[model samples]
Target: MKQRLLLATLICLPLSVLAQDSGTQSVDNEALTVYGRANVSLQSSDEGDGSYSDLESNSSRFGLKGKGQLKDQLEVFYQIEFGIDLADFDEGDDAVSNRNQVVGLRGSFGEVMLGRYDTFLKDSQGSVDAFTDYEADLKSLFRGENRPDNTVTYYSPSFNHFKVGGTFIASGDETGDDGISVGIIYGDKKLKKTPFYAALAIDRDVADYDIEQVTVATKLGATIVGAALQQFERTDGLYNSDGYLLSASHPVKQWVFKAQYQAVKYDSDKDASISVGADYFFNADTRVYAWYTGRECDIQLYQSRGCGASNGVEQDFLAVGIRHDFSW
Candidate 1:
């Protein structure tokens, strides 16, 4: 009950402030925007056993974002985003989870944000993952994909198509080791105005692993191709792993076709996955999509990482869904 109240307060407080200020200021310089997306799918899944049908909610979320002028060339910004599960309305904390809730300042020096958010290494991936938030998300085969609390991040202003950023994760009193992440990126992640994008990032002691990753994507005509390679080492020096991803997508009018391949190897254990999907757009804000992904995993990987199945088992998923995004 207390958690619910706290969350409600956090959400409503900003709106109340916006209401009081909007009447006297320009909406463009000081305004609050409510935005979110709903993404749900029906899936036929097999986890190395029998097949079953289920409905899945793919990280659907809603939030409020606002920015206010603070001075001559400075601004204060904030966002309160939360994840909602639409497939099953279970009670308790699982019903709603935090996403990128943060408060920050931006100016000529760039931006500095505080609170819970994705690390620099994680953000460096950008939109290269063709199957993000789905069964084939890069998090399934790679380390350093972290969104941790008690974080402080800084992003430098773009200089000649290049930018750099860093994140510091405070371990609090419970843990003595602090985590750090850093990244350098070039070009635009959306590829809307740029022909190519590239990023190199590193994480140390975040989520109990050290990781180095490189990601690149290029737009050729109407097609986009992306790839990523990563190396992960356990902070305790007990294990080391490597992974790579290749993905491509092509759009024809209102239809898009996508495919991806990814694999990870650790010692003698290996896991690999393949996925194919397509999307049909009703408009810019809505789309319907379907995808199929299959994976083969080694037992050793299951024991050590709690991923995949024992004895080189295979798992598969086929899903179709609709997504609608809205902003106000």
Candidate 2:
């Protein structure tokens, strides 16, 4: 408890005190900035042969971030973010501990990040995930989001609406595992009518089966849209796994409507999944969302799971939730 109190005080500390000890600007516009969101939701589900409805008691929490200019061309950044499982906050670790942490550096050439950080491809499309993240939502840019063990990522500077990023991943186990990925992004932030932007990336890794993925995104005037296509090749499996996503968002002042489509297929044996989701923003810091998905894993309905294939088994699911963000 004492430790938590100290950490909280430290985050709220004034810049004057920080400058007195460092003699440099400790906080700028987004420097020393903090951001995060909270979430609450319910679910109506069908597990192949059974159906049930449940009100989720726990949701998501918020986060805080701090950025420091280390030099004219160099900067340091850190983010302390976590989730609140309202369903069981007091049952396990404290609510504040379930967070995303990172400490990295930025410069004129590029940016290098360490600690609990997301992958290059995930970061590139994170901007589009602003509205969705759930089992049935393919628009979920980071399929599985988190700081996976030890990650070192490099982000290239943007030029001609194009940028590149790469990363090296370490196996958290003593076996000392290692893998890497490369990605390229292109887009225009300014659109004459709808105001649109887009980015595409291809990525791979040795862990969790070698994967080849491409993510694309574009935002229109009052509407934001994105799409992703990926292939997951299991080393020991007979067929590969493939999936694609399409999502769009419409804005009405502080209120926004969002939706996504997801489809996944595996192997020649057969299995597929499709999902759709929606979001309504009450404000920048708060929003409500819901999604429905259906999937089937029948091993007797396909020739292969390369690009286009479908199976006959079906499983249905639904998720509904809300989020709130607050930082100081």
lDDT of 2 by residue, 171-246 (tens): 6666644555556777643333234455555444444445566655565656777766777654446546676667
Residue range 1-328, candidate 1, lDDT tens digits: 3323423433443344444434454324677899999999999998777899989999999999999886555678999999999888755648688999999877666777889999999999988899998999988878877899988787878998899888878777665567888889999999976789999999887888989999999987889999999998889887788889999999999999999999888777778889999999999999999999988887374332325444468888999999999999
Candidate 1 residue pairs that clash: none
lDDT values, one for every candidate: 0.84, 0.56
TM-score of each: 0.89, 0.72
Query: Candidate 1 at 235: error in angstroms?
Result: 0.6
Q: After superposition on all CA atoms, what RMSD does each candidate show versus the true structure?
A: 7.4, 9.1
Best by TM-score: 1
Collision count for each candidate, in order: 0, 13
lDDT of 1 at 41: 99
